[model samples]
Target: MGLLDNLKAKLNPAKDKVSGLAQQHGDKIQHGLDKAAKVVDEKTKGKYSDKIQTGTGKAKGAMDRLAHKDGTDAGGATDTPPAPPPPSSPPPAS
Candidate 1:
């Protein structure tokens, strides 16, 4: 194979692996990205808020593409997993 072809062959496996992982964990990954952006914004005191927001949006879009390979939503954007229920309080004695 030519140099370019050899390089492409070597990178193809890595690309496929990344694609598979993205399909499996895209939503969780996007959520983490959003959380990290929030933390960074807080640390910078909103100085880079606009840029952070843009990055976060792009990350989410990429996540959507990875997770939705079939061009249909796979519970990524519209269906955020529900948070755990709050703990129940003990009842008072009668």
Candidate 2:
């Protein structure tokens, strides 16, 4: 195998391990992200609230994508169904 192919072969196991860890500890990772964001926001005295929010959202989106929560299966096909919307119209006035 060539240099790039050999490197990929060696890194494949590590990649799988990282994916598994990301799936297993995703919640804890997200919580840590939130806590860190809160501390930074407080330290900045809310001056960068919008930027902080945007960064936090992007981080969470990346985490979700890493965890494969975007509905794509291992085969890269979307095997999950879309989420249902919330109910509307307050029980039709009873």
Candidate 3:
């Protein structure tokens, strides 16, 4: 098999697992998304409000796709906007 196909084969199980989890916790997941977005917006003092809102929407849409494979629209990609990486804490030493 080609490299891409081999990688896909290995990831299939993980995709399935994510889908299952999404289905089971779809509502809860969406709720968490909303909560997180609010917190992020608040922390950033709304400087990147539009981008943050758009990202949260896209993320929630992706999660919806994971939860429901019915091919329902996840809205358009036009709403997507550039986002900065999240603040990070230093990694633990090995």
Give the alpha-carbon lDDT of every model: 0.65, 0.69, 0.69
Ten-residue stretch with the least lDDT total in model 2: 85-94
Candidate 2 residues lying further than 4 Å off, grouped into runs, are 1-3, 73-94
Writing each residue's lDDT as its tens digit, candidate 1 over 1-94 gives 7999999999988877887899888768866886787777767777677777777776676665654553545454444443232222223243
Maximum-TM-score candidate: 3
Tens-digit lDDT track of model 3 for 13-87? 999899999999887887787778777777776666677767876787678666664455446333333333334
| lDDT over C-alpha atoms for residue 83 of model 1 | 28
Task: Report the lDDT tens digits of candidate 2 across residue range 1-94.
Answer: 8999999999989877877888999889878877777777667776676677677777876666667776776676766543322122112221
Better of 1 and 2 by TM-score: 2
Candidate 3 off by > 4 Å? 69-94
TM-score of each: 0.63, 0.67, 0.69
